[model samples]
Target: MQSPAAPATPATPATPATPAGNAGGIDPIVALPARALSQEIHARRLSSREVMTAYLDHIARVNPAVNAIVALRERDELLKEADACDAALAQGRPAGWLHGMPQAPKDLAATRGIRTTLGSPIFRDNVPAADAIVVGRARAAGAVLIGKTNTPEFGLGSHTFNPVYGATRNPYDTSRSAGGSSGGAAAALATRMLPVADGSDFGGSLRNPAGFCNVYGMRPSAGRVPYGPGPELFLPQLGCEGPMARTVADLALLLATQSGADPRAPQALPGDPELAALTPASVEAALAADLKGKRVAWLGDWNGYLPMEAGILALCEDALKAFPAFGVDVEAITPPFSPERLWQIWLTHRHFLVGHNLLPHYRNPTRRALLKPEAIWEIEGALKLSATDLHAASVERSAWYQALLGVFARFDYIAVPTAQVFPFDVNETWPKQIAGRAMDTYHRWMEVVCPWTLSGCPVISLPVGFGAQGLPMGMQLIGRPRGDLAVLRLARAYEQERDWVGQHPPRALL
Candidate 1:
């Protein structure tokens, strides 16, 4: 934990003059949570076109500074989406959960008639003829497509810089990074460029940027949200797409619209829960405030393999202590497996996937140059791995999963700092070190985030507190496998108890 920086005087951005005495109007539409706008639309207090126009206007205003959005549909096309929503209203018909909302998807997700560059020059002019499953569902539910958000080249790195669209700066501070490969999506949400955005996480793509930008992000359990339009479409046990928003409620709203089992998935199960039904009020009502009667554990420092920032541990400690105030009996608990072994297993699995799927692109000088060196390195490393090594790693991964059963026996939830340190210089590839210990790998410091990724557990990063430099910090709440609602319930209660939603960045342009 780094020492807290001295608190500075709160600075406000020069308030833009309100048009036509509309004091409440003209504020960034992107800032309003999705649920708020949906309610406004359902009540007919605001037209869908008005919401779409406000966001389009904001994108015009801020895209230069952040480079968050990639492609905007023609104005007529956007108006058509809004017109359809208005027509439904005229017919006395109810729109779906996200009826008439505006949103931006990561460029990695295919969008029909919209160019999805994937942050590479090769696909700069490429446009898919059909929407990916998730995008189609959102559009059918009445979510107007605002544009495409940026990503790292092929979404291979943690930072959101690429040749096609360039870099997306942190909304809080221009010089700092917004975090990546979901960096642009997080940046858009933080600055209210969109009320809600879509993001995918194979590693810490979703959570990292959320923590970096002080927003709520969830990486749902594997198969919770279907992913496709990629080379490997059937493997639901690995990566998935989820939602990001300014608040948990908005994230839930978007998740509900996009989540379900696709017929294409062989392992797909029936009855994906509707996310819209999980409201903040309903979730809070379900969560027990006091953990005193419940068992809770904190995997502090993960057996001391990774170094944490100075105050990070303290902030987490304070948050954990407060859980007992909510009646959770808090105690320290250890996993049955070693952290080193788990890291090895994770590396093995990740390398094989990347190597087999992505290595050939690295062989082409043109394609190789378009990708980040880190991505190439990962592929090359994976290519060299032997079958014996992969088999051993698989065995270890299973053993680790079984080890988690013991922890589940005594505790209902596990807590850890979302990232080892708070947001750092956005220009760097990854944090070089933490608390003086050398961070040798690009993803080493993110070890706390990997356990849940590997185990396919439902995890949510809640804005717990702030640390040095006035930047926000979050603690991850890890739930038992398939306990998505339970984790969200606890997060909703904390949000109500803490009321951290109103904390916004300074208005001054840096």
Candidate 2:
């Protein structure tokens, strides 16, 4: 992949700047939520050119240390797009939802004319001639393409590190991980380098990194946001692409643009009519989602069956207490399921799918050496499974889903910690252990996230507060299957009282 160009001086603006406050070299416009910024741009309170310039300056100044944005488009071309946006607005043409915002697609997603390495040396210079469905949606919504963020090699493990561009460090602490495979997206959001970001999740790629970086990430209900295509179309509840941002409302805006009917994806849902019709006003209005009289179940560590690091349970418990204050009845509850069985099922399906899709690369003489150890382990594990084993695992997954549905029958929402542990050292590919228990595999440390993924339910990771070590801790909110709108509403209500989403990492880390 091409290295990001040296920060270029922003082009002269075609329209004047907005009246927002500017202090400490930070553009006050950058602090505004994406929804609000879109309004400002439309109202002529801010120009698309000015907004894009501010973000470019911010990215140039802050991205080097964390290395979240591994590749970039020339500043001049991005500014030109922004200028065209302003010109259209000047002519009184209606703008799309994200008009003029700067965004970088996750490396795993294809982008036309831009290098999408998927963090692998083998495809280091590969560029697609077309945009992934999600990227097309964002561009149609008026987002100016900046570049692609970093990810793990083939997104094999939760951690985001690859030989192509190296690891993406947490913005909170340069020495620690940002979490993956959405690590770059989360870190970019935390540092205010981009207004909003896009990511995909399977086994906590979206939620874990958002937790680690103190941002908000949503794993929309299966089929709510459709993935375009990949090596294989069918798998055991494979990954879903979703939105990430500093605020739930911003996330809502991005989601609205990305969620829609796609004939190519047979699993795609006919999304919420309201969400499909979402506007800036609608997104802003969702912030007032009523929490009164709602029933919430707080499942902390699956009743202590799931291993977690020190302070995580207590931190999550304290975070859930706010639900009561929001007028929701909150109680500790255990969903019926064996954590061990669920983990085994998840591994069986995940390994089988990944292995089936990627094994050919391993066998190829040209690409064999490019395979990472974690990828090899997963593919080999898949080799040991029989057809009967896959069917049995599918049956177990169904049982797990039914058990979660039983819990949902008793509560409107279930809350849990987003990760088993907080951010670990960036240099380490995966945690050796958590809470004194030796992790049996590179992915076992993130088993807390697999249950929700396995259930195919809507999940959101919200920044609650910090840990004893000052790294961010996030709590997960799981909605019943296909309850994407409801889950987002609950998150919006909670975000109203918490300032965690608005908090930024220490400036020193940048």
Candidate 3:
């Protein structure tokens, strides 16, 4: 999988001219995608402080070459909350379906007084007195938080570097790797800097940084996006928290505003309790989900027990052979358990939930050298597990979830490849090897996103293109175990047959 280095012609960056009242007057308002700039900020024709000062002037021209909006917050307190959302749209009132937009969240999402750094240096000057029911449902669906992003520490790793806000990179190519525990929300929605962000996954941190920053995340369907305060008998759906954008209708308008039902989240997912009132025609009916005659299996590398990197399985096999020329059948197949039994039931349920959530930072001996030797080998490998190795990994995860519900009762969708190698070298922290094999652990080069994070089901990464070092390459999909809106209508029918989120990365990372 390591063949990349030959393609260099991208360096884009020279547009800095359109300032006076920006937003949907577009002019690179970070290439407009949050549902067409939320219908031009709900047809007030854009003036939530001109789309929050054109996303703080495109994060001061591309967030210092992709650090991915780390702690941010005060741009005069986000232009006085976009001037109280343009005086609540000049008192005609009723606005919020992400009304004024401008979010950030996902420094492990907790934001009330903001500064919630889970990119840990002992929560680096913490904060968060509240919020985090998906940031209070993305601020009751009006968005506008404006800071946080970057992660890794408590979000263990996919690679968004951390010791309290450090590495993010890869806006197609800063040095590489944008993938992580939502690598700064997939490098801040791949350079849009934040139109829609928020993320979390477990073994692919929101599908390997939305396939290493091309964009589109979604890990859903484990009680469809709910999350909570702490470990109330953890490990039910091997970690979740969703949404990241650059389209699939702005990731189903931030997954219908981070989904619903949260009696302090006892496995959440009550969703469609009017999906906590998300509108814009239910996000254009979950972005016109179609996929023609639907069938689709195409499991790119699992049969080889995943070593991948033949140029990311030839750009996920040219996007599953362009979904059988869009009539959609596809079908390469390979899922009845064994990427060594889904990596031993994802390393005994993710190292016993990373040793009960970081064994109090490895028994705090001065925060034990700020953890991370793969969190002290997953907290001493879940203190050497063995309840007969978690009942033989819970009887091989219930016969690998009834052999993936018998391959979704004859395949309606499975797919794979959200990353096995493409965006490496952000000063290298993981991938000790891919094509030549060897990576024994440090997230075994992401066991093809830990078998859909142990198949709680509903996955998604998207972006399928570019790789001979020109970077980007996504894929994944999965669905049908609750099938979060049938895996977002087959990823909005292969994102309306490959719009690839309207391309855009090399405006020189700006």
Winning model by lDDT: 2
Candidate 1 accuracy as lDDT: 0.73
Candidates ranked, most accurate by TM-score first:
2, 1, 3
Writing each residue's lDDT as its tens digit, candidate 1 over 1-510 gives 121122143221121222222112336455556776777788888888888888777777777887787787787788788878888987887557577888778999999888998888878899999888788888887778878988988787667888787888876666777777798998887666777889988778888788777788888877777777555665435667888887666776677777767776554444455444554335334443444466667777776776888667666666665565555666776555788888888888887876667777787888877766677778988888999998898788788778787788877988877788876776777788888888877778787887778888888877655665556666788888877767776776667656444444423122
* TM-scores of the candidates in the order shown: 0.89, 0.93, 0.34
* lDDT (CA) per prediction: 0.73, 0.82, 0.76
> Residue-wise lDDT of candidate 3 within 208-320, one digit each (tens)?
88877777888887877888766562454688888878777677767877887778887776777434455665666644644677787777776677788766766666666
Candidate 3: deviation at residue 233, Å? 32
Which candidate leads the pack in TM-score? Answer: 2
Tell me the tens digit of each residue's lDDT in model 2 across 395-430: 998999888879888889888889888889999989
The window of 10 residues in a row where model 1 has the poorest summed lDDT is 11-20
> After TM-score superposition, what is the CA distance of residue 322 in candidate 3 from its true location, in Å?
17
Error of 2 at 460 (Å): 0.4
* Superposition-based RMSD of candidate 1 using all C-alpha atoms, in angstroms: 4.9
Cα miss at 312, model 1 (Å)?
Answer: 1.8
Comparison by TM-score, 1 against 3, better one? 1
